[model samples]
Target: MKFLLLSILISVAAAKISTIKVTGTVLCRKQKQPGLEVVLKESDSFTPDDKLSQTTTNKDGFFEISGQDDEWGSIEPYVYIFHHCRILKEGCRTRSRYDVPQPVINGVYEMSYIDLDIAQSGETYEC
Candidate 1:
């Protein structure tokens, strides 16, 4: 009905839009890792995390990505990196997630050089 639609519109308009920027470099065995997938996501408690943006690392193994989402409160942002470092299996990659710190929520979060040769905590293998 009209009343229900109005309420929904109001709630949607009231949600706050938050944006985040992230940049980093990836290295595998001390060499630049290109064509690695990087994703920016907004974590959700009751549903699947929303993917805001995704990109592959450049030839220099550098990536810069930004995204925004609307939420009732501040959006919880994180980065996922998929790479084929130290993997013996075929058609599989290692996935790693890095949560953006609260202090750098609204600002640019810079992850300096990340060496994929070293295993990251909580990383998983995915096909």
Candidate 2:
């Protein structure tokens, strides 16, 4: 019984932890937004929890967010891009949400081309 319990503990210790890697872009008024904030968190949640990670877009409006969760599949992650969007220039969502796929163990999830674009109103594109 002692040996069996030890083996189980070892297996649990070796279980893979999940770390999410996300990369994407932010566009506003049809232009790349540098220094804009990009946030990663649990999607569809209102727990007042802190974000898993936060980053700023690069000069070309690109960003990367990476962080580790205690366990795999514990959180449904999403990206948020907050920008000041001009009306009629580019259609967008204010607290834009983009799904980050469930990651493989210790894997890199390269979300290379997500465009978090701001829009004219909530009526368009229902993002």
Candidate 3:
């Protein structure tokens, strides 16, 4: 049992560390949408998704977030945007998730421009 525990500990310690940076701009009704929340996260198979970084869009509706994680395999990175782009209800917003492509791992992933006025496939409403 001791030997097995030692091996497991060593393997966990040897997990690979990966880093990613993401940048994007948000637009609502063809105008820059400021103050929207943006989050960088890592998707996990057996556990809750990990939040890497979080920030709000600037006055220009531009946001930049970066994160790092250690895992047995490559980290699956994504971005979640929370905004009140189209909803009229007070204190309600929509959350959208965008997965980073594998080719952009370990480097900067430019999302270009995201227009919140256009609905996404898997977006959800939140309060």
lDDT of each: 0.92, 0.64, 0.92
- Give lDDT tens digits, candidate 1, residues 1-127: 9999999999999999899999999999899989999999999999999999999999999999999999988999999999989999999999988888878877899998988888878999998
Model 3 pairs whose backbones collide: none
- Write one digit per residue (lDDT tens) for candidate 3, span 39-100: 99999999999999999999999999999999998999999999888899999989988999
Give the per-residue lDDT digits (tens) of candidate 2, residues 73-93: 355666666665543445553
CA deviation > 4 Å runs, candidate 1: 1-10
- Badly placed stretches (over 4 Å) of model 2 are 1-16, 43-50, 72-74, 86-93, 103-105, 118-127
Q: What ranges in model 3 sit over 4 Å off?
A: none
In candidate 1, the residue pairs with backbone N, CA or C atoms under 3 Å apart (3 or more residues apart, or in different chains) clash, namely none
Backbone clash pairs for candidate 2 read 91-118, 91-119, 92-118, 92-119
TM-score of each: 0.88, 0.61, 0.93
In candidate 3, residue 114 scores what lDDT?
Answer: 93
RMSD, model 1, all Cα superposed? 1.8
